[model samples]
Target chain A: MKVIKITAVWCSACLIMNKRWKEIEKDYDVETISYDLDFDEDEVKEYEVGEKLPVFIFLDGDKEIGRLIGEKSLEEIKKYIEELN
Target chain B: MKKLLKYILVFLFFFCFLVNVNAKEKVTLYFFHGDGCPHCAAETTELIKDLEKRDDIKVVKYEVWHNQENSAFLDKVMAVYKTKTGIPYNVIGDTAIVGYNEANKFEIERALEYYKEHNDKYRDVVKLIKEGKEVKINDHYSKQDDKTDKDTTITIPFIGEFNVKNISVGSAAVLIGLVDGFNPCAMWVLLFLITALIGLKNRKRMILLGSIFLLTSGLVYFLIMFSWLNIIISVSTSILFRTLIGLFAIGAGIYNLYAYIKNRNQDDGCDVVDEKKRKTIISRIKKFTREKSLIIAILGIMALAISVNIVELLCSAGLPLVFSELLAINNITGMKAVVYDLIYVIFFMLDDFIVFFIAVKTMDVIGFSTKINKYSHLIGGIIMLLLGILLIFAPGIIMFNF
Candidate 1:
């Protein structure tokens, strides 16, 4: 199973969440695709984000599986990961 | 020969008389100041020293509380004037100097100028008072009963007083806030959120989650900081404390930039799994929980956010405490602790909230996090560098004149 983790450079919470996700990836095969919002207008619009950042979306074979918004703890993300597994 | 001697003696006598008259300017400069106020004392000392060297200016110093004769005058005047404080005021001729130091200097100058211009007029009034003569109400000098000119009728408490130092602090805080908001450290945090949110396949969920995260992080940071401020104020004076805070801000700015540059080159190089694998993994995580439980996630993220903004928050907390300490040390009592802390926190938060809102809005509008990624390190570097340099050097700049 592959997991895609999207992130940005400047978000403190995102940077933190990214670290947690990376740790999770150590045990699980997760594919993290990081994007800078400054350069990716289309991707941002496709997500229909209002004025918030550091959103996490879980997709399974082009189907929406789960979504996490805002800053989340490592344990919370782990729980989400467990659910998916 | 007799006529010539007599004429010369008369001319000499006239000349001598004129010289004596000119030398005795008799311009009494009354400086009213409080014993408890540091700035007032400083101003008083400076004024006394400056006047002592000048032959034309006669300085008469009055303590508002100690001078019983002037108490009635002060009360009568203050009863009509609307201002901050009634006592510990200055009256140089007709000009009133309130506050201390630079403010008193300006007021003194204005009063001296007025005395120079209206010397004869004020002399006449003084003569009447000394002779116990009944003086009539005039345009320039009016009785307390006259209220014709509404504009002039309003009682000024500390009219003609200038508190330049205090005013400067206020202006500086605003400038610092502006700089802080635009600082690289803050910008980096904003950029990260924007980029991360944009990458989500489910756009709505991404936006919702992102907004929640940013808001909660900001709220938590400010709340904790404000609470800490209350704790600090209980121990120190606000003015000295604020100066220390300013120094710390500069330090933090420098550190933030340094950290950003140090970590710029590090990469974990974790391989990206294919879309199929990513989806399968996401589905498995989804199957575990239907309701999104972000409490744990929020806490974790909050910790990260705190780590990133620890410097900034500390600086923020320091500023209010320092200012409060300064005010307290200056013997500005009567301000309730809660009210004082509340005002400081409100002002501090007002500055931060504006920055946070702008950052979030800009990211949402731009639609991509690439810009954030590109400039994060650079912004962080510059902000930290500038802040550090400013903090370290500002005290020297302030003390240089001394």
Candidate 2:
């Protein structure tokens, strides 16, 4: 499973969530790809997020599984991932 | 040997004389200020700025409300010197100077000169402490000397590693929360909740359900606002941000003032209502409970409450942002951020609960009619206006020069 976490330098919520995601990834078969939204315009467009940074797009074998936006709890993200599986 | 002893005695006499002439008087200047008083705030700022420039004098500031002795003294001073209002008053030696005018400055200078004249008396007192000698402080010196031997000698317990940024940010968040909770705008929500509860047939259930609903609504409001705090702080310095906040506050204030005026006009004209009409209104409200589900009704009430003060909420959202930004720069960790947010939300809800209960009790005592329950809207509006004004002017008014 490929979990691409797109965020900016100044996005504090993203940084905090990223820290939690790192801990969670240690237990799951998750490949996390982080990108700076300010610089990576092509990556942001690829995710279909119009100017919205700090969005998590979960992909399972080239198919888009789910996407979560805004500041979400680790539990909420975990639940979303579990439902996808 | 006798000649050598005489020479040493002369040298000792000359050394003592030089020490007396060169001794610096340790003058402790104390300033007291209030939270809301503009003049007091200005005086304190000026005094602080002035003290920073002077190495010879030291200023000890005590917020009147926070300090028991200062508060008591302030009360006494208020009673004794009726003309002396606001802060930055200087109590030098025996005299007091109120305001930051030239006259006050001259008076303060005179007092300082008098203190210098009698500097020899206090010199021994200060010297004893400096020399590590046990000095008994009498009442005369104690009144002027804000610092005692114990104060200078005792070491305060260090709670954590000293971090300036953390402390500043933490304090700013707390201050913002306090200001938000205290805002008159929040008062109206409490008023409406109380009136609505009292109007309900099942008073106990209504109170409980209403409190829960209001608390939940408050939580939702807090979370939404807290989440947006970082965004606000990130872009706070922008002109667009300032204008949005300013306009929102002013607009809310105007709306509230209009509502209050309209309500006042209605109250003056209406004295009697037909019994049938009153009964119909009561029946309609009663139907709300019988026909609608409790969960739906709670949601409906929450929606109604939130809708009425949407502007106020928007304005308050700015506070958390300002606070969070201030905190974030101080390296406030994720855990501390959660704790600070929780504290703010809890305090905010508690304040609402208190105001709600008070308004309910007041209405009950006065025996306000069910038909006039809508008057709570007017109260809420007035609170909004006051809060808007406070938000708009508080910082500037507080820092105004005397």
* Best model per DockQ: 1
- Off by more than 4 A, model 1: A1-85, B1-38, B46-171, B182-196, B199-207, B224-402
Query: Candidate 2 chain B — worst ten consecutive residues by lDDT sum?
Result: B141-150
Question: Best TM-score goes to which candidate?
Answer: 1
lDDT digits (tens) for residues B133-252 of candidate 2: 553433232222222112223333785334332444455445456545544444433343444456565666566555765666576766665576555434332334433554565565
Clashes of 1: 55
Off by over 4 Å in 2: A1-85, B1-167, B232-292, B315-317, B358-402
Listing candidates in order, what is each one's chain A TM-score? 0.78, 0.86
TM-score of each: 0.33, 0.32
TM-score of chain B of 1: 0.35
| lDDT (tens digit, per residue) of candidate 1 on B1-402 | 999999999999999999877754467665554344455557657776787678767765555434455544444433233222333455444434444535346556656666766666444333333365554423232231112112223443788533333343344344433333333333444343444544444455445554554555455554554455444433222223334555665555456556556645532111122336334433432332222565654554445455545655643443333334333332233433334444444443453354345545554422222223324335544544453343333322221111
DockQ of each: 0.11, 0.01
* lDDT by residue for model 2 (A17-79), tens: 667678779878899888755457577667765433357788988888888764556687788
Q: After superposition, how far is residue B304 of candidate 2 from its true place, in Å?
A: 2.8
TM-score of candidate 1 relative to the true fold: 0.33
